[model samples]
Target: GAGVSQSPSNKVTEKGKDVELRCDPISGHTALYWYRQSLGQGLEFLIYFQGNSAPDKSGLPSDRFSAERTGGSVSTLTIQRTQQEDSAVYLCASRTSGSGGYTFGSGTRLTVV
Candidate 1:
């Protein structure tokens, strides 16, 4: 894809189950980010990957949430032991440089019951 792309646009899962969301960033982009947004809420940063430097996972709400960007392109977000509160739209964004514009994916809506 020319722009950021996310897989499994919608997911419904039982409580305690786990889910994995994928993102493919634009080619040559050196920055990638993951965020979550609940119903009528603002986006909350989850993690960030920039070049070879360490990923800033400080925004992750819990240890159960994790993400990784591989080969500086594709990224994945994993949520363990999903709970009702974990239900939300996961968004992925990427940028080619610090001052460049960003491209965001449509997001993956997760519903936990």
Candidate 2:
């Protein structure tokens, strides 16, 4: 793909259910990031993967949230025991190493009801 791609553009899940969001970055991007945007809130960094280095999980909100990048191209973000507060637009972005610009996906809108 020429740009970042995300799956399940919109997801409606019952409270306590689990959900997974997928992201496929550009062919050669080396840096991938996950962010969350709540209504009326700014983007919150969730996780970051750079090349083969250990992922930076410091931004994950809780133990229920986890993510991994496979083969350094595709990534998945899983949310367990979903809650209403978890409803948000999950965004994925990618950029080449040392690049200041990023290409972002349309995002997966998760609504927990």
Candidate 3:
């Protein structure tokens, strides 16, 4: 993909069900980040990964949320035991580690019903 591409642009899952959102970053970029935006809210960083840098998982809301990067390219965010509060837009952004414009995916709108 020329830019970040996220799977399942919209997902509606029953409460307590787990869901996985995928992200494909731009080719040759080294920095990738995951963020969540609640209803009309600012983005909350979830994780950050840069080539060889320690994965910054500090922003993860709980153990129920986890993500992984493979080959420094694609990533996946998984949410477990979803609650109504879990409903939000999961966004993926990628940029060159040193300097570059961040490209954000359309985002996955997860709604827990």
Candidate 4:
């Protein structure tokens, strides 16, 4: 992809439902990350992956949140049993090997009703 891409710029779901978001990173980049930001809030790191290294999933709010990257390119973030408080923007970022900054996607605006 020419730039990082995220699917479904907006999502509205009822409480307790599940939603899945997608991200396609820039070609040849080796580092990926996911973060969350509530309306009027700051970005919060959720997870990160760098090649074969152990994924840093420390910031996931709960076990119901999970993600996976395939072939070091595309990634998916899945949320289970959504709650109203979960409404927020889910952002994805990627950077080339040894890069100092990340390129972010437009993000998926998830709204849990």
Candidate 5:
């Protein structure tokens, strides 16, 4: 794809259910990032994956959130035991190792009810 691609533009899950969001970054991009944005809040970093090194999961909100990048191209963010507070727009971005800017996906709008 010419740009980052995220699946299921919108998702509605029950309070206790789990959901998986997918992201496919541009070819050759070495860095991928996941972020969350609450209604009027700024973007909150979630996780980052660069090349083959260990992923930086420091920004994840809780133990229930996890992500992985397979083959350094496709990534998945999984949220367990979804709660109403989890409702937000989850975004994915990718860039080359030395790029100063990132290309972002449209994002997955998760609504926990």
Candidate 6:
């Protein structure tokens, strides 16, 4: 893909249901990131994957949230036992290097009832 792509732009789930959001980043990009934005809140960093190193998972709110990047090109974010507080727009971005600008996907809007 020429840019980042995110699947199933919108999702509505029961309070306890789980959901998986996918992201396909630009080819050759070495950095991938996940972020969350509530109704009117600023983007909150979730996880970051750079090259072959371990991902930074410090931003995950709880054990229910997890993300993984495969082969350094694609990624997935999973929400387990979702809660209403989890409702937000989940964004994915990819960059070629630390100093480079990020190319962001449209994002997946998760709605937990």
The per-prediction tally of clashing pairs is 0, 0, 0, 0, 0, 0
TM-score of each model, in listed order: 0.96, 0.98, 0.96, 0.97, 0.98, 0.97
Residue 5's lDDT within candidate 2 is: 97
> 8-110, model 1: which lDDT tens digit per residue?
9999999999899999998888999999999999999999999988999999999999998888889999999999999999999999877866799999999
Q: What tens digits encode model 3's per-residue C-alpha lDDT throughout 35-112?
A: 999998999999999987788999999999999999888999999999999999999999987876789999999999
Pick by TM-score: 1 or 5, better one: 5
lDDT of 5 by residue, 8-98 (tens): 8999999999999999999999999999999999999999999999999999999999999999899999999999999999999999998
Query: Residue pairs in steric clash, candidate 2?
Result: none
| Model with the higher lDDT, candidate 1 or 2 | 2
Q: What's the candidate order when arranged by decreasing lDDT?
A: 2, 5, 6, 3, 4, 1
Taken over the whole model, the C-alpha lDDT of each candidate is 0.93, 0.97, 0.94, 0.94, 0.97, 0.95
lDDT of 2 by residue, 1-113 (tens): 98899999999999999999999999999999999999989999999999999999999999999999999999999999999999999999999999599899999999999
Poorly placed runs, candidate 5 (over 4 Å): none
Q: Which of candidates 4 and 6 reaches a greater TM-score?
A: 6
Model 1: lDDT of residue 97: 73
Output the lDDT of residue 56, model 3: 97
Worst 10 residues of 1 by lDDT: 94-103
Clashing pairs in 3: none
Error of 1 at 52 (Å): 1.3
- Expressed as tens digits, the lDDT of each residue in 56-103 for candidate 6 is 999999999999888888899999999999999999999998697899
Candidate 3: list runs displaced more than 4 Å. Answer: none
lDDT, model 2: 0.97
Model 2: residues with Cα > 4 Å off, grouped in runs = none
